[model samples]
Target: MKRIWNNSWLQKGLRNSTFMQSKSPHQIDPELSDKLFSIVNDILPPDKQVKPRTGLLTFGDAPFHISQPNQHDTKAEFEHEYQIVTEAMAGLRKLVPLFLTREDADQQRTLDLLRLEFDAKMQQGAPETPIDVAIDLVRSVVADVGGLRASVRIFIDLFRALSERRDELEQQRDKFWNLPHRAPEYYARAIANRLAKLYARKTGQKPTSGASTDTGDASTKFTKALEQIFSLLDIQSGARPPADWAIKNLTEEDLAPRMSVLENLGLGPSPSRKGLSMSRCVLPEGPKD
Candidate 1:
């Protein structure tokens, strides 16, 4: 029988097979995968991590399954499908935060699994990102319940409480950009959304606090937002001095920078400057365009 080489919307994703082949699960040291899974598994809710037959977040239409009678099955196809299945689980890692936030017994185990998958996907180059998607979905799911504010606040929680981790997330975005069609907008939109949450977390009426005033380890979403807002504004004003966040409030325009690229990625501090710095590589849309 002749093989049919048909393409689907997922074909673009399939093109990302190079990402999957690089880190086949069997290649992962069994001891390490076990140890890591054990640690994260210990902290998560029992039965939550189990890949259920169905759920709110399922691979409903994700073309990870392809059964063909005409074609000979090869390792490449098998590996690609495996990559799709594994890559799609990217969001479950963020369940680590859910479990950790609740201090579940299996928090350690869940976190370990998350770390292992996050690292493996990154190293393998597949960029199977469930964390990013999960957060976005959470926002979507919450929006109906809390309206835009809930969505906005969750974003704030992500940006400010975790702004220090922005560097790592940006690196993942850079990796994803190298994939098919090169979704630079994916990075920008994600960053902007997070920034918006960071902004709303700050200056907005709502409040969430971590750490103690007595300990002087206070971390309010406000501080992170201000820093990011100033950086974004600086990007817009052609590298103006970072605004004195000491002042009262900031507007969206105040946060808008020229193209607003820096905060979109690399808001994490760098040695090149006291504040954010770009990764220093020309994207596809360089000056030649």
Candidate 2:
């Protein structure tokens, strides 16, 4: 049992396969790991949990989808993300035998000292915890038990080589990313692109030129609207657009172009040709108080 259980492949995978300096904490200990494996083995169902689909459960779940149409829909999607996180954490809990920590140091110590007083209990074998009991076992894996740092370096290097191929493009991508964008026109174009993406995400289709956001109350309605707008405007946020965001450079024309640019890029929900022509389009609510 010990020979097969302490297989070399397991050691190589969990530590060297990833090329990290260390294995997951569970990788270090044998006895404690066995305990966790036993527990998780008991808890996991016969099959793995199936991923759900997009829109609804009919196609299986795609956890990243917005699914719904409003802010509340987005919030619901995030709540599902939380559920995924909690579920994964629960699985990790089952896979660990010693979940104790520095704060738990005293409790584990008490268990250790008590074992001394009642050595028979150690011989008899103790029960388990929901969190498992591996981490509190000991520090520093020895050469005999595959705890040597040299082995770790070998794995780390190999892992780095493998991952090096995977994310190599991700690294060099940033160099050419905005290289095409060096001038104010780049920012202008970017704002246009972002506006289209926003329109697509909200409506899931190309926006019409007639779909402009019409407000009845600027102070009340725009108070909430400005929070989203300033964030898009790349201005500092403090409950609302900063004084300088309003006074210094943020003019109606500056904001106006963004709307027209957005309509050109594709965020037009309004039918009017001047989709973002703010001066031509926006009329203040109720004569501004």
lDDT of all predictions, in order shown? Answer: 0.34, 0.32
Query: Per-residue lDDT of 84-191 in model 2, one digit per residue for the tens?
Result: 544443443232223211135576677456435444332222222331223212111222233322233333334333332223323223423334632332222333
Q: What is the lDDT for 17 in model 1?
A: 47
Per-prediction TM-score to the true structure, in the order listed: 0.17, 0.18
Off by over 4 Å in 2: 1-181, 185-195, 201-204, 208-227, 236-289
* Residue 33 local lDDT, model 2: 31
> Model 1, range 259-282, lDDT digits (tens) per residue?
222233223332244421122311
Question: Looking at model 2, which ten-residue stretch has the lowest summed lDDT?
Answer: 61-70
Q: Which 10 residues in a row give candidate 1 its minimum summed lDDT?
A: 61-70
Q: Best candidate, TM-score-wise?
A: 2
TM-score of 2: 0.18
